[model samples]
Target: MPSHVWNGDDAPPNIHDVYDYIDRELKTLKTKLITKIEKQFFGGIEAIQFLIHIEEIFKSKHRIKRVKSLIPRISGWAELDLFTRTCYEVRRPGGGRDAGFTKDIQTFNAAFQRGIKSLTDLQDELKDLYCVVQTFCRNYQSLEGEFDLKWARETNLELKSAMRGIETLLEEAEEGVNIKLFSSDKFSLEVAETCDTKRYPVLRLFPDLFQKFHFSFHLIGKWRANDQIYLEDIQFKLIKTKRLQRLKHEEYNTLEIEHANLLSIIVEKRVRVKCREIRDRIKNLDQEITKLAGLKRSMMLEKSQTESDIQERKRHLFMNKNVTDIINSKDLDNILGVKKDIEILSKKLKSLNKSLKLNENDLVAKEKEKVALDTDYEDMRKSVSRSNQLAFERTELSKEISIINEKIQELEAIFYRKTDRNKLSQAFEDMKYPAGDDEE
Candidate 1:
């Protein structure tokens, strides 16, 4: 039957039949997937075709959910419902571009951890068709054992397209298994090929606790070489079904050891989980310390730079104020401005004193003449008063003589000491002076 053309649109395969038949057919195909593909030591058992149908159903229903779920690390990242072969997703809180991505990642991780129940559910989904397919493949392999290469080739040829379709679906199945795998690191590699629908290959690699192992659905396709029966992808995966049970127990112990190991390293007893968690914290500290040191060093460098700038603008303790006010200070730089003002004033005072001395000499020479002129003027004024009858002539003569006597007196006052230049210069110098010194 063409894969797309279901046995009947109206009637679906019994969920049990689907699971069992696929499981049986998977046994042979699983070997083909492993032997043909390049892979590692431990990949878990996978119901390749069953997963493909799950993906198909998922795509038919929640296409976007199915698409987005594909981003997880591997197929095993999700939980399986083996009984119904019905898959659900555990999405990261907010995986895209949002602050919620972090929260979503955490949620996804938690769901993946709870995936154990999902895997066990796979057994419940097997049924009638599973037996038919299993029997059919067994018979085909029996013929092949009898060197029926032509029949085997012709069989593969007849199912080539369907085989390819199954291969394509299997490739997309890993992510369709569950929601948690969205952010989990778990993923599948070296998946099954188109020709191998007779069997299925599943692998699960867990670094923290679970040991890696291979799953094969084959029984009849077992290759016997050198008189030794080499179970390839056929019969069973690299691991025996028996070992899986032991692995589960060991996996739990490993998980405990991992938790205790991490607890010891955490320097805190509250968190009780994987050793990987503690290692992560230690790794985080390495980053934190580096960042802290970088910031501290930067601050120190900035402080030094600021100090250098201050030094460039600093003034001597005593000269700060004066230096700030000076404009045309170049000439005055050598001579203290305060001191220079005093010196300039002293020179002016000395010049004034010399002029005073010359005035004194001139005054002495004019003193006797002024005294004689004053006596003549007084006699003329007395005559004017006695002979007022002399009228206008006498009055005019008296006024002229009085003016002459006033002029002579004015000369004496001018030549005499009025304000001493020495005293003025002394007062000016004393009023404001430079620091630390005072002098004439």
Candidate 2:
């Protein structure tokens, strides 16, 4: 009743069942033998051909026919049985010792065993080569991506830092000015005369004609705003005649003070303008220094990454070289003479690595030099700032001094003319008086 049972009994005992059972067994055995032959012999053949391909890659060919010839041809169960029986006979004691039994069976056994061993060894070698090739290809593929990512990240950080510096500089530039170099109402001017001779009362009343008086004045005030200048007041007043004896000292002093204050204001404004220019220049230099520092940092990071990449590549190349050398020594030793070629290739790779290292070193050195230049630029910028400030102060002081000197000269000239008129008036009065008395 079961699918496997042909009749009602648990086992089929008829002639037909017996023949069917034998046929099924033979078919199963044949399939097994065919599968074995395909897997072992055909697979071994493919492996040998792969080795031949590898040999061709090295540009050499060594004949490997012994292993190839040992593979048995088995198209059906009959040939498979024959091959098995032959193997059994070769292994049996004293079975193939007769003269009629040729040495082909022994040779087949030797070659078959050698082929199996060689196939296994070649498979391992190919596996190693495949692994090395895969690793090398993978590294090559990822190298550029890694470098680009690192560079982008580092560049971004540098850019951010630079942006922050710019923002700070901008904020500082926007702040108000604090320097005040000069101020009004801090100085006074006066005029006076120097006399070397005593004059008569008439000449005193008219000193201009009778007495030659040198007029001069000194500025005697100290600079208060920022301590940039100082002056001490001196007098250069002319002797008055009878007709002009009431000169208003208070009014004249007030006028001179007002003039001096105006001059002080002008000097202050000019100094402020020059100081603004200097501050602007300093701001520009600060921006430049910040930019250079950012650039230098970016270059340093890039150079470091470049060196790391070069070292990684060198290590990978060294590993590849070692693998190539090992494969040449172990697998391709007899097949192709690749040892010398591999050595030469390794040497070339080493030289290339060395060149890359040197290039990276040069770039690093250049970055260092640029950093030094950035420092120098910063120093120069500070010095320029100080120099500009000092120059502004000096220029303003000089202008103030010149203005004071001009005022003093004008006042002195005015005093000289007044003294001369007074002297002429006095002479006229004395002559008029004498003539009137003589006529009486």
Candidate 3:
């Protein structure tokens, strides 16, 4: 028979071939799914950039509002025309003269609207891809379980069949030897004739006869050749059994290595996905921190202006009249309200400063978390052996993120409280002292 022929009676069926085929299919599917996940993961960058661009647009709009507040309203057509032309020159800077603030604002609003729509669409797509990947992971887990169970069942059956074959061979050898030595009359007569000259009985010669027949048939002159051949076959089978077991062990090791490789691929992809999510969150935190810093600067500026205004009012009162005359009911109430406004602004500034510090601290913590996540991601990506360790690290990072979110919520609450207090203090100040013509 040809060496490649696998259907021979003496040859055990190569059951591992079936497992190899299944494993190949699984590997192909895993590769395709991993590729899809990577593509989607990288594709999310465009969406992230869109969101960042939207934030930039909002920032630009805020700057425009500040500039508009600084520019007093122009009356009459000539003044308005001059202001419009100046705005166009400053904003366009060597571009068209027709470009003006209104046009610029419209353009920015249109871009913002487009960006919002694109971001919405991309977010939806990303969510769908995320769902698909989750489903794939669940299915892969089920497939892994099936593969393990199938492999175990096949290996167990193979081992049991091999043991049964060895037992049958041993039983056959024992039965053949016992019948030839104890139940054959012809063999007994031959043994008696051979031992007659030595005056040895059959029972006395039995040990020597059995040993002679078992080891070397030449001592008995080739008598009962079939029994000698059977004994030699049993010895050959026993000697070859160890070689078969070694081959089985090597095949099992190969299978285990392949399974480990597949599992590592799954784990590495999961880590990369999680790392990307953390990175995006860190970016959002950075943006929020920048926004909070701007708010803090604005609040400080407002507080300084309020303090200066209070000092100016006190100086005016002392310079324009006697201290006793300035202490009338209306003047006293105005002074007290100015002091109250100063006090309220001071408290708000303090609260805002505290909130800003907390945000900075949170930002630092999140940055550190990002670095740790990056390190863990790299380690898991590069080393297959460490994939099992990622789960614990992932859990710890999740907890840290939750804590940071709580801190952010508290900061926001403080900010809102400060805003409400500022509004109440402004109301009291307005009621106690109405705006003068020059201040208006």
Candidate 4:
């Protein structure tokens, strides 16, 4: 007989067989998932490891009695006797040949079919998610310490697209499972009447974690390799324990009820046989909680240290505001003004230098001319002495000419002064003599 297609056969598998088959299938499926996850670790393990962490979350959510009772039946992974009894009751009303009962069985079969189909689809989705993750991990590894702009952009796009694909696949897988659950009419009404199904917190928050990883991808170009790794690891664990406080809250309630229940049972029945088991389980839970708390504290400390290191790096690499402002000055007008002043000063300096060069040339030429004239004067005196014996007299006459020129300048000065004095005396005599003497 086919595993999924169960026509109203004379030999339908009993509930035990059905559950056993499902359990085996579930184990196989888990093995496949683990194998796929392990292959994903070829490039890196952070993202895939997150998926494993999600398994822990699933286990925790389903650990509750009510949730545990609902999940298996609803998902068609296991069936409760109540569900089987309800199916039989519907059939018995028509003496096992009711057309409506057959229809109901068909519907039930279809729901299981859908569940099986969803499982297959979920596997495919997981495969695809791992492929993207593998590609993303490879890119991350190859692009480590890569600061090339073009490469970074392309790699970021690829990584981002891969992240989105992973997220989409995860959502589809979740929806597929949920749809499978809702398809079963026997369990649907029952599930709805009971406590609301609590979704896996990590599943809901996974994309956010994916986002955190992607965000770290952006920092690869700017942050040190070690820093990026630390950031991702720290943030990954942080997100893992993000719902811990709430879990602790739930744990408190669960423990109280469980404690009371255990006490009542032990007091009423005097059952010591199961007491050790219960104590061991409680001890294990306490140990788990303690480990989680310790992990959280360590992660927090690492985060703080990382932050401080990053700050120190920034402080060392980046200039202070004042210095940075001066180097990258945005004050256009001030810059322009300074430039203009420098240009004007440069022009003035060039002009002054040119003038000084010209003056130096003129002085050099005049000095050469003076030397030439001195040589000519000496030659002329020598020629004069050679041609005539009166060279000495000529010299004496030249001296007399210089003396006479001086005397001429002095005599002219004396004559001008005497003439002014004579005019004044004459004026005085004319004033004394009057107009009558002038007429006579």
Please report how far candidate 1 places residue 90 from its true position, in Å: 23
Poorest 10 consecutive residues by lDDT, candidate 3: 135-144
Evaluation by lDDT, superior candidate among 2 and 3: 3
Error of 4 at 312 (Å): 97
What order do candidates take by TM-score, descending?
Answer: 3, 2, 4, 1
Q: Rate the local accuracy (lDDT) of all candidates.
A: 0.35, 0.35, 0.41, 0.40
Runs in model 4 lying further than 4 Å from the true structure: 1-76, 80-86, 89-102, 121-129, 140-440
TM-score of 3: 0.24
Q: What TM-score does each of the candidates earn?
A: 0.16, 0.21, 0.24, 0.19
Tens-digit lDDT track for model 1 on 231-279? 1222332133335535544554554555455445443322223334544
Please tell me which predicted candidate would have the highest lDDT against the true structure. 3
Candidate 2 stretches greater than 4 Å from native: 1-345, 368-395, 410-440
Question: Which is the better candidate, 1 or 4, if ranked by TM-score?
Answer: 4
Q: What ranges in model 3 sit over 4 Å off?
A: 1-266, 303-322, 325-330, 380-440
Better-scoring candidate (lDDT), 1 or 4:
4
The lDDT of model 1 is 0.35
lDDT of candidate 4 over 288-392, digit per residue (tens):
545555555555555555555545544533434235445445554544554565455455555545554554555455555545545654544444344343334
